[model samples]
Target: MNNPSLISGTTFNEIFAIMEASFPVSEIRTFSGQRALLDNPNYQLFTEKDTEGKTLAFLAAWEFPELRFIEHLAVNPDIRGGGIGNKLMSSYIHRSDKPLLLEVEPPDGELEQRRIGFYERLGFQLNPYSYVQPPLRAGQADLPLRIMTYPQAVTLKEFQRFRDILYTEVYRITVPSSR
Candidate 1:
């Protein structure tokens, strides 16, 4: 796995292809917008590639002085159901120096529950505080999501701090209403 601040065009295209296939438009930035994030000192794109140089999985994360938030993680769609996600997450968590956080949809469906379970197996406890993910792009509705934390659960104060950072730093939004 390589967490690179700068990636070659070919590698980026490969990663972006997987991202587009894995996430909805509402959940990701535009191609140019994503490319621009490499300039941000706090952002890192961790990619796991095969011996043949194909991107197997990736995680886009933002680091702060006290915490880290994972924005996106996806396995190449063609290789779905493989152990790549588990391996990728295991590697990332092993390298974390502070509290870790990520967002997930509520367990209202089989797929959502299964996704939460996958992270749970990796040791992320779903936080109980209500959260609504800010619109990632203009005109999109806020996405109802839950935050999962590593090591242990966060208190309401920590959750608020993390959410504030996500709004003011990551999404650059005014605090939006939540559930």
Candidate 2:
């Protein structure tokens, strides 16, 4: 399958709608905040569109010197489970050489566990170390989430490094002393 195209201005609103639908309010950045990320050289929004040009799925990624972080991957809810997601992620992994990292909700429920299993089937290993995703919006407390890495599991030091970079760059916040 061909790789998805980089999202353009014309597709921004449609892509954001997919994101808002895929993630909970506390987990997603504000609309303006998301727009700001598009200007960052490290960030990318890849979208798959139908022949008629309607978006089918998207993968939002951040490229750091040491790692490739998948911030979000959402398929159109109407057409999910039809292998679009697998193709999108496989295309990304085929193009990327850096270690790929992503956050997953802890195995708190069946749906969450299935989400983890989805990545696991794609060859990502779940890390056991504790992780807290700093709030994406104001007035929300830190959220506990797990780190999953493609190719292999991460060491404690590696996890800490990933956490530091995400906290500083993506969330724009200082790592709490308690962590």
Candidate 3:
């Protein structure tokens, strides 16, 4: 049976492979920039493993005293349709004592809708706030990002505060200045 586990240095390579397969290289920078946030006292990585002990899925998050921000999540393509993703999310939510939050792409098309549906199925609700995330690259266009909260309902003002904190603390720390 597949089981979820907390990822550590021993499983870093396997976790990176799952992330690379699930997201574009540029969008998966967290795998490379994780060190910068390690000292933040809130970063955590959770991974799911198969019976053979191979990492199959991962969820990274930052936990504040009163909130948890899901930073990244991915399931190995080879095991996508199985329950790994859902299991990983359930594990995190179960462990979180405070409200859980995440950012997702706006429902611009079928893909976005499906993505939103996945989170919704896991008990997350969309926060009625609009936000534009900083561009992935300097020349890339800024994308519309939406906030989703689990368990607790969030107000537009609260969502905006979360976005601003993410932009100033997480984004600034990980993104390098364009030369």
Candidate 4:
């Protein structure tokens, strides 16, 4: 397989089709909601390409001066067990100079455990605090979100500030009813 390429809305609709095919509807909805906010100038899309130059994986993030909040990361389910996801993440970590932050579903099952473990292998540490992510739709249940911090030593206060900004800016636009 080949490495993925990083792209923006210039090719996002096509990329989203791959995401929709691989992930659950709820996950897709959440991703679409989040992507809408990051579509502005301050955000970036990092995509991985295969040997044939086809998109294999993608990671999207919002770039602030001091931090990069990974909003969505996905690898096609057909190629899940391969190193495609790892490569995509490693590429971002290598290219980014700022601390990275992201959220993950709580480790509730084998799948979630594996997902968390994958991030851990990439040097992400789970913050002890918990949060309720705003819902993807009105009257929908809020998600139980866990924070993962890259660069290990990032303070809890820093993470909390990031979370606060995310809820206020991203969540408000994506899921206004939850506010």
Candidate 5:
């Protein structure tokens, strides 16, 4: 996993490919927008590559002083289920003791439930808050998602503070407070 250094050239292209194949358009940014994120000091892209140096999985995250927000994490669709995601996440978890947080779709269906379960297995608590994720780009509506935190569950105040930080930093946009 490359840290502090930015991913560029073919590696960047390959990572973007996996990102597009793994995530929905509404949940992701455009190629240009995604590429531009590397310029942000707080953002980091961690990839787990195979022996041939091909990107097999990647975790995109923002590291704030008190919070580590995992924006996106996806394994190579073709080679998933081999425990790479778990290793990657576990490694990231051990990298720091700062409180970790991430967003996931509400468990309304089987796949979503499975995802939440996976995180739960890793000691993440799915917080039941009225969370509406700000759009990653223009022309997209706010997405209703749930927050998952490691180590412990968050109180309403903590959730609100995290939300504000995410909006102000990750999304780079602000909205009226969600009561």
Candidate 6:
């Protein structure tokens, strides 16, 4: 089995480049903001590299007491469709017993639908409760997203608690409704 190790320094920079290529700017934090997450005790970044030491895939997650929140998961576009993404996710799940939670764009389009299907194949169930992801940067609007939970569905109460933690800890924003 390929071992997933904590990423840092040049490794982190390389993986960040892949993240920028894979996700829209609005969906990701500024590079500096992401770097700051390295200091957070709850944050974790794990990568799988090739013999050449190039990053093949990465999984960034927050290890909260009640849940494991996958902040991002991406594979190098040059070598996708070879199960690298699956391996990364499987490793993450195998290492944690907590219920896993992650946000996803609603399945309104083909790409979005396919992404949801991909998670479902890994045994993650989509939660129907409404959710809004706080903006990664200032002045941007909150993004509407759906929650997917591993092992089972999440109730509105559970979603609300998760949202509060993410808004306060991850984004440092007060949930509008809470205010």
Model 2 C-alpha lDDT per residue in residues 1-179, reported as the tens digit of each score: 32334556668788888888889997789999888788798888888889988888888888899999999999988899999899989989877778999999999999999999999999999999988888888899988999999999988988888888888888888877665
Screening candidate 3 with a backbone cut-off below 3 angstroms (N, C-alpha, C), the clashing residue pairs are none
TM-score of each: 0.94, 0.93, 0.82, 0.79, 0.96, 0.93
Q: lDDT per residue, candidate 6, 104-151, as tens digits? A: 999999999999999999999999988888789888898999999998
- Better lDDT candidate (1, 2): 1
Worst 10 residues of 2 by lDDT: 1-10
Q: Candidate 3, residues 1-179: lDDT per residue as tens digits?
A: 12223345657778777777887645556545654454566677777777787888888787776678897889989778888888888888998578888888888899889989999998999877777767544456666778889886687667766666677665663433330
Descending-lDDT candidate ranking: 5, 1, 2, 6, 3, 4
**What's the C-alpha lDDT at position 24 in model 4?**
59
CA error at residue 177 for candidate 5, angstroms: 7.7
Query: Which 10-residue span in candidate 3 carries the lowest summed lDDT?
Result: 1-10
Residue 176, candidate 3: alpha-carbon lDDT: 32
Which residue runs of candidate 6 sit more than 4 Å off their true CA positions? 1-6, 176-179
Off by over 4 Å in 4: 1-10, 30-38, 173-179
Q: Clash number for every model?
A: 0, 0, 0, 10, 0, 0
Q: lDDT of each structure?
A: 0.89, 0.87, 0.74, 0.72, 0.90, 0.86
**Residue pairs in candidate 6 whose N, alpha carbon or C atoms collide under 3 angstroms:** none
Error of 3 at 36 (Å): 4.4
Give lDDT tens digits, candidate 1, residues 1-179: 78476577888898899999999898898899898898899898888899998788888899998899999999998887889888878888988669999999999999999999999999999999999888877789989999999989999999998888888889987766561
TM-score of 3: 0.82
